[model samples]
Target chain A: MESDKKIVWLASYPKSGNTWFRAFITALLNNGEVDINNLATDGIFSSRRLFNEQTDLESNLLYDEEAKQMQGNVFNHICAKAKQRHLFVKIHDAYTYNSDNLPVIPTQNTLCAIYIIRNPLDIAGSLANHKDDTLDDSIDFMNNKQSVFGKQEDEVNTSLQFRQPLLDWSGHVNSWTAKLPFPVMVIRYEDMLADAFETFKQALLFMGIKTDKQQLETAIAASSFEQLKQKETDYGFKERIRNTSFFRSGKAGNWKNELTSQQVSAITSQHQNTMAKYGYI
Target chain B: MYYYRGFGLIIASQIMLPELLPYTLTSTPDVHISIGKTPEKLTAAGTVHKVGYAINPNEYLLQFLNVANYYAANGNNIIVEPLAGSDEKSVRLFLLTGVMAAILHQRNAVALNAAAIKHLDGVVLFCGYAGSGKSAMLTKFIQNGYKPFCDDVCLIQHNDVKAMAAYPTIKNWENTFTGMGLPIPSTDNKIRPNLPKYATYFHDEFDTDALPVKTIFIIHKDHIAKSVEIKKLAGIEAFAEVHNNVYHRLQIYPMKKEAIHFQAISKLVANINVYQVTRSSNTGFDELFQTIQKHL
Candidate 1:
């Protein structure tokens, strides 16, 4: 890999601050002046449209042979454009997928990998609130390997209780942290919020991106929960954004008020170690 | 409504997904199938199993794409694509394996327009838009120690695990293969010529499992610059760039499922990273490949 090009594998199952963190990092790295009220979220690494082809941008649709091949070609273009300053992404599929197989770009230029883990209990509450499924439903889907939006017969019987959320939480974290083919720097959303500046500093260092005290304070203040929410109202509703408010609540421990006792125990029992690591229990 | 089989999936349209392609069921897996066409006799092939409701033709075509034109328009994700049959030749039972992949990506787990094949190094999409360099790349990749997932066209089926592409043919274009600076399309079973009777270009001897869509590199030659350039795109921008440059970007005919299809591609684009490849990158083809190797 080229010494400068970065391959930041921002792994997290779903709603584990993957997007939230991605949004914040987007704000910070751009001009190093964080905009707490309104953050920008458009990049080759996200789901937004760079080309005017006007194709659907849903996250679960299937691609035909031509479309798939085209994606590879365009991705090569994007990687070259971003060079070392770009954010190459992976949705955390567990398998260490290397891009070199296709020979689309300078494979050796890969430089960095980053992973983010959040409390599953909190994530479950958020997903259930936003999406139609529940934590229990998500769990079964996770273990079983299917989705409510999908057909039934081919579905597996993992028997997850609110499995979607749990799986999102577990899959996102475990896939990257447990056993990785490459080195990755893991960050917890809770820990990020618990001590914003410290976490921010660590993240920068991991990327070899050094920042002074001023930049540190600026990134922190810009990424603050309150600042992000206000930005969501303005930029969140913007049509260009996939979602107007990319930032939801950044507080930790909200699981206590949001989840039912059963949900709590289910998450604790299911993801006990991970939850405990972040002191979510 | 009827059931169709190919690869390992029992494509049952009409009953389960309300949003499948509109097409009648044909028992046999025929790439020459059309949205309005159905086999005279429904031949029961267990290759495809239908468990849900009776599959309909319209929904099936809408879902798994039965026509060649429709595939040519929007099925850009496919690697081993079926040739759209010009005066020169036609591609049948085409399969596509996405090269430049994501870790454990299943971007095309369902859909009839594609197929896959796994090899030692990973997956290499056998792709091109007639002039986009599909066979040329295939021959070169093979000569460079790569394997085949499909030739010009690939076969695909949906399954419980994911959408899969089928191994078909190399159909090494004699002159074209040599043009790519590789051996003449060898007699290897993996390689074959387009057979006129079977409605396919060639019977490729090899193929692999479902690989995720990794990157998209456009092939355009700049006589002046004579180099290839690579760049990365982030978020919606990357998705848009990829979805449009796709040869079949406008295949919806009525464009009814444009939004739905875009969302589907977006999900795929979101999960994996995307990039652009300059035609031959300012460096010659080999240097371009080396450049991609070093950075990606």
Candidate 2:
């Protein structure tokens, strides 16, 4: 295993700008000609197939606790065998420990992480559209501490990803940023939309990736919201929700129009302290 | 000792396997399983590979962590050494699932990680990654008057276009049994203790004999898919899909048997009708079954 295989974490809550960040990095890596299908990184962190491929065992056979214990090993195995110098793994799971008191994402080979957060109000609208639920339901889900993605007990979860524990909006944000084992660069989704070039460049610098000004500008231009939405319109994205575009309304504050006043108040009330700290209010 | 018939082979085991359909009449066992001493590490080994378990093909050793250890030779005999403090059920489960699959692979059989049911046409194999609704789909077909041929693992005999039946029982989550209004069978063991799924054994609807495979449906769960859609797969895509679903494919590398495995899978793809069945998350089992029935 080469030390040059830089393992950077692309951490984000659901419906955040994680995909946009990945698109920008992919475009930059591909010299501004990005393939929507083939990304620059290896894969997402919660992929069940990757765990099976790495461990030679069916992950679904094991208990959730047992599966979490092996996740760190899976990451290490992938890092050891990676051919690329830098690997960006997108993770929806909050930074947490397994039953054995071990970090789900091992920090032994991890270089750093970039946590992307969005305003709870805006996220509520996007999440509602993404999940095909009501805005109020999405808000409640974000506020619920027991929120988990892919938590299927009745039937087998056949998707490529595994069950990810996302404690809540605040818990998710704090999990990555507070008392972290490795260095993490917190970039707001609003900032990315406000100043794409500066925010993206800062994120790249945090990952220790060196690039020229032309490359940065090209990546930003190539991954612009309009261009991305156009690409999605031309050839559909695999990650898109049912009958909905993945690049749906990349505006910063569409919640004002989409969310009701009561819904907005509920989101703010649930995530008040964290939202206030991040200037969401 | 208990004798069981599964995957067209008679297995003589020291431990009892209630999951396998009883082999009433049998001659010599094709595969033998017995408790024996297993080395912690292979001494004379070649190309050692570690993935939860360490496999050294030169020494014919497959060692699991603190559970059970296995060594196979001549593709007909396997020696099992259960680790300290490991219960017989846990050891048996590992042997029946992983070790048995590995032994079959060594024998040059095209074993797939899938479940099968004896449909009206022929055996319909539901192949995909674990939790891809293979067992769930098989259960639905079973409830609809189809007999379960095998669950979790299916061995494909390419020469005759038949699928060899393994265990008669299908492991399913608690909710699945409840959803179908079926009583949960009591079992001392789980797939794993923390996992809510339990082993549901079938007594009357078990088909011990092998069935000719009519179609292989690779199931995938699509969150975005609104309805059940079945698409015919052809060419490289079909081959790749089947290859991906091959049981114990990782053994192909450490065992240095890629050529034979590829040849076996290629023959299977040529002979079998393969399709990709995408089921939406929200689709009811009855509706999905009807859609599959319509396609058939």
Candidate 3:
């Protein structure tokens, strides 16, 4: 079998460093010129438009479960038709097995996966802002194993996004970091903030992208949080939820001031095991 | 078999498509849909996938897992093999969507993903992705005394640059009906067993003729937008708006209809006025209606 590893999965839970990393890549691809509006990458894994384009079928007519079942094939088709060396796909769906007990993302065409993990403590506050909900509600959502994004009511399943099944925060973390057929590189959000050049360089090297220190520094500076947030302020981000800013704060340990003691305890206790494994505890 | 008139063609189908106008005139059907034996795979096709489909220059095959396998050939015939116990409504829905689009593209028609409203001597088209309030605006326009031309797919004929009214039905989610203060019909009209979308037949108000293409509005809703803004697109921008709205653009290349699609879109763009309309998500339809009414 020809194992053509063409797809690089940028896997993460929402509010993790997925978009930021994609922005950095976009800058690198464009000689350190970042246009936040038009980020460079294959779109999100859950785009209904991409599915329709690849399969030549209307995704709106299919049920969510049926759509989920076809994702593996949809991705494989994407890889087969890819013209670039690496097809960087941003995915929020947890690494999960489908109804047929097979991996939702096929292993044959996968090159590598960059799984971005963040402290659930900071994530609760950031997620609250992104979802335009209460912090406590966001905390509860992170702890709920049944949590899925873009799952609308049956009456209005007309969104351009597909349903992304994201289990609880810990489950989301473990799903990507677990043993898999292909290589998985886990990057902590705090680490990326502490040493962005080193962290991003390591990820790019893992995907066999050749870059020098100067290019890395340029891309990092261009994709910095301040730059991204300012761009969003000037021209709104389409990915932003209703009335809420997408790039709220890129600070690590933001939970120190934002999250209350009760909220911190709630996130830590629920995600203690996985949090400890990733050095969050 | 049942016969219907749609997309400037007479369609004879074994399955009943309630959305299209009934064809009572005795003439040769341009397309035929029947249940028959379809090859498990296409041998001469260029692209084939494990997801149950194949495509080539003249033929396209689609298999809805556990539902049916549809084979369309040369813009004239569609062969359907329904799985046992499959319902007719589901089969008919697929036929109207992907199969019918393929048929139109095969015949070199410039079909757009738009909703058209009949004006004085032409049709005003509202084009957008799904959930961009196209249907809501269409329903609103109908209530405000504009005649409905086409609900989802608007077919523009070549040489004449006119918008042909194909199907007389409008399909919308349950929320669209309740949002418009209209009642959804019985559950039997649901498009699929598990989907909450229903088909509303508006045969009485449907214009069964073609109208000249007038103006096109590419609509979008920005959540943070404060007010509605409309801009006229000229030259390349106007051309792109029509090209981007092609109903079956993805299949054009695979079917070797690029010349046909490009020529049709190029010709249509030269004859129509295109505008981009942006509105806040919270805004009501009245402002947009009034703004577009001025342009019309």
Point to the candidate with the largest DockQ: 3
Model number 2 iRMSD:
3.0
Candidate 3 matches the true fold with a TM-score of 0.95
Worst lDDT window (10 residues) for model 2 chain B?
B56-65
Tens digits of per-residue lDDT for model 1, B166-265:
3343433344443457444324322113221111222334323455444333333332233566667678876665455432333232323355446555
Q: Rank the candidates by lDDT, best first.
A: 3, 2, 1
Overall lDDT per candidate, in order of appearance: 0.42, 0.79, 0.85
The backbone clash count of each candidate, in order, is 171, 0, 0
Evaluate residue B253 in candidate 2 and report its C-alpha lDDT on the 0 to 100 scale.
76
Model 2 clash pairs are none
Q: What is the TM-score of each candidate against the true structure?
A: 0.43, 0.90, 0.95
A1-281, model 1: which lDDT tens digit per residue?
45445556565655566655655575567755454334443233322233212222211122222233234333444455564565646442332222334422123444556777777777675665444466666555433332322121212111111012123355446655664445678888888877877887887788777678786776667666776567656544221112223455667778777777876776677667766765666
Q: Which predicted model would earn the best TM-score?
A: 3
Choose 2 or 3, whichever is better by DockQ: 3
Chain A TM-score of each model, in the order shown?
0.69, 0.96, 0.97
Every model: Cα RMSD to truth: 22.4, 3.0, 2.0
lDDT of 3 by residue, B136-232 (tens): 7888898798888888899878777888876888878887777778898689989998788888887777776778989999888777777889999
After TM-score superposition, the amount by which residue A161's alpha carbon in candidate 2 deviates from its true location, in angstroms, is 2.2
